[model samples]
Target: MPTSIRRRLAPLLLATATIVLAASACSSEPADDGGEQSSPSPSAEPTDEPTTDATDATDAAESGGVCATGDLSFTVTEKSQAGGYYLITASAEPGVTCTLEGRTVEAGFGSGVSGDVKPSEQAEGEPITMTGSIKAYAGVNPHSGPQEGGVQFEEIIVSAHEGDMDPVSLKLPGTAEVDQPIGTNWHTDAAKAVPFSS
Candidate 1:
């Protein structure tokens, strides 16, 4: 072949070899799937641990039961008197019930309303004593079974109003029970409101 012809053929051969090499390289590379990468598998759930009856008991006591510990107090004040009947005022504890000697009484200040006490139908102006308590349970009818335990007060006086005597000034003695430490102000116009721990 002539020198010019040889040169032209050489350049063409080089170009074809380069194209073949590029094609081969492209075919050898892996294809992308366009899917998201998977994340690591989740860990196993925690196993149940063994617990004792004492541990359960402790939990119940600490969770606002009668066995739980706390302080509750109340002050009684007389509101008014009509036809020898005296209206009284008392306090209410949230999430608890108040009772006199386990007797469920009404809450608030008034005569014949909730948390007020009256003498028996045949009783005269006798000094009244009431033992009460508070509970988290929803109490049944006062005429039904005994009050459940949670918060309680015992032997607090519910005195009738005397002439010229201030009911709020009266101090009564009773037991105040709570499931937890409570700083609630309860007011009643009865003499001697005392609290005992159980």
Candidate 2:
């Protein structure tokens, strides 16, 4: 082309070349450090890979992680009489799973004159797994035979076995005529559970 045109285009060509070279140098990939790269720094940004915390949680879930107390909700179904005692059905809230091994989340009534609770004849020593809508049973009876009169209780409190577990307070369907209620440890078989003894 003409000399004037060539002079004008020369600067534009040089600028384009510089931009290309700078872009080529800006790679994010870590350069090969002769295979001697040190461990990842604590302050490094997270990558696409799963983090340690995520890995640990996954492993725990796979291995049956212990059920957190806060994640559990306990409820008492309506009370009914069976045999010679009152039966209380304890149920776990939805989406909860827990081990009853060595767990003593038991039921109790008023203190002092009202009397205390004891394990029912049916309380199971083996651990029962509670999950979802699954339920356990406890038997209670305040009045002892013909001589003992039933104690009137307005509310029933389920004691927490672990410090982490929260105790549940339930309003009785009616006055619990308890003399010395015996509560059974939570068990899968409702027949085996009995209320606490005073």
Cα lDDT listed for each candidate = 0.31, 0.59
Candidate 1 displacement at residue 175 in angstroms: 19
Model 2: lDDT equals: 0.59
Compose the digit string of candidate 2's lDDT tens values, residues 45-73.
56888988999888766544444444446
Quality of model 1 by C-alpha lDDT: 0.31
Q: What TM-scores do the predictions have? A: 0.21, 0.54
Per-residue lDDT tens digits for candidate 1, residues 1-198, read 899999989989999999999988776653322222233333343446535776787765454322111122334322222211112233333443322222222231223233333222221222222224422211111111134443343323332122213233223233333222111112233321211111
Count residue pairs with overlapping backbones in model 1: 36
Q: By TM-score, who's the top model here?
A: 2
| Cα lDDT, model 1, residue 91 | 32
RMSD values for the candidates in order, in angstroms, are: 17.9, 11.1
| Local lDDT at 86 for model 2 | 55
Candidate 2 ranges beyond 4 A from true positions? 1-70, 77-84, 102-105, 122-124, 162-165, 194-198
